[model samples]
Target: MHEMTIVAGVLEIAHRQAAGAGATRINRVVLEVGRLAGVEADALRFCFDVARSGLSAIAELEIRDVPGRGLCPACGASRDVDELAALCEACGNVLDISGGRELRVLSLNVD
Candidate 1:
């Protein structure tokens, strides 16, 4: 799965950051994953468990779920959305996605 690639990148960043800060181990990693990012959190966690070694072998992962948001141009309103091509509930027009496409590391606890 692509989640393995994502996990590999995350771990690489974690290792680099920890080493840059003169830390030998990573204690925790916090990630903010948006609903519209199209990546499964469970798969990421599983991949992390399988791929992590060395400095991050015992690191804990914390994933924060972010809800998708959209703006309706026809209605001039913003609302929560579940998918990318969601229709506006108020005016039946297509919504322009405003948020919830993020997949990034928010923080890392290292020492």
Candidate 2:
């Protein structure tokens, strides 16, 4: 799965940071998972454990979910979305994506 590669990338970054701080262990990793990022939280967690097992920073994972913000193309109104994708409910028009496409580590904790 692509999640393996994605987790590997995260661990690589963690390793760099750990080396910079001379840390022997990682305690936590805070992740932001946006609704439009197309990354499954469960799958990411599974991959993260495997990826971090042999690494220096085998940190605990914390995911913060971010909801998609859809702006109406016709009226320019912004609202929270609960449906399949970015869509405007007020004007019945396809939405222009305003936010919520991010998948990244928000912060790292090391010891």
Candidate 3:
């Protein structure tokens, strides 16, 4: 799955950052994943465990799911959205994406 690749990238970034900071071990990884990012949280967790097993430093992974939001460009209004293509409630226009497209490593707890 693509989550494997995503976890690999995250591991790479974590290693780089930890090494730069002179950290001998990684204790935790905090990730902020948006609902619209198209990533399966369970798959990510599984892949992270498998991927980080070789590293010994990474101990835990925490995922934070963010809800989607949309903005109406015509009416300057914003609201929670469940789908990618949603019509604005204020105006009939197609809503622009305001949030919930994130796939980021929020923080790392290391030693």
In model 1, where is the ten-residue run with the lowest total lDDT?
A: 73-82
Candidate rank order under lDDT: 1, 3, 2
So what's the TM-score on candidate 2?
0.86
lDDT of 2: 0.79
Cα displacement (Å) at residue 1, model 1: 0.8
**How badly does each model clash, as a count of residue pairs?**
0, 0, 0
- For candidate 2, give the lDDT of residue 68: 79
Off by over 4 Å in 2: 54-57, 82-85
Residue pairs with backbone atoms closer than 3 Å in model 1 (clashes): none
lDDT tens digits by residue: candidate 1, 34-74: 99999999999999999889999899999999999999989
Off by over 4 Å in 3: 54-58
If both were scored by lDDT, which would come out higher, candidate 2 or candidate 3? 3
Model 3, 95: alpha-carbon shift in Å? 0.5
TM-score of each: 0.95, 0.86, 0.93
Clashing pairs in 3: none
What is the C-alpha RMSD, rounded to one decimal, of candidate 3?
Answer: 1.3
Best by lDDT: 1
Candidate 3, 1-111: lDDT as tens digits: 899999999999888888889888888889999999989999999999989954434569899999999999899888998889999876789999889999999999988
Superposed Cα deviation of residue 102, candidate 2 (Å): 0.8
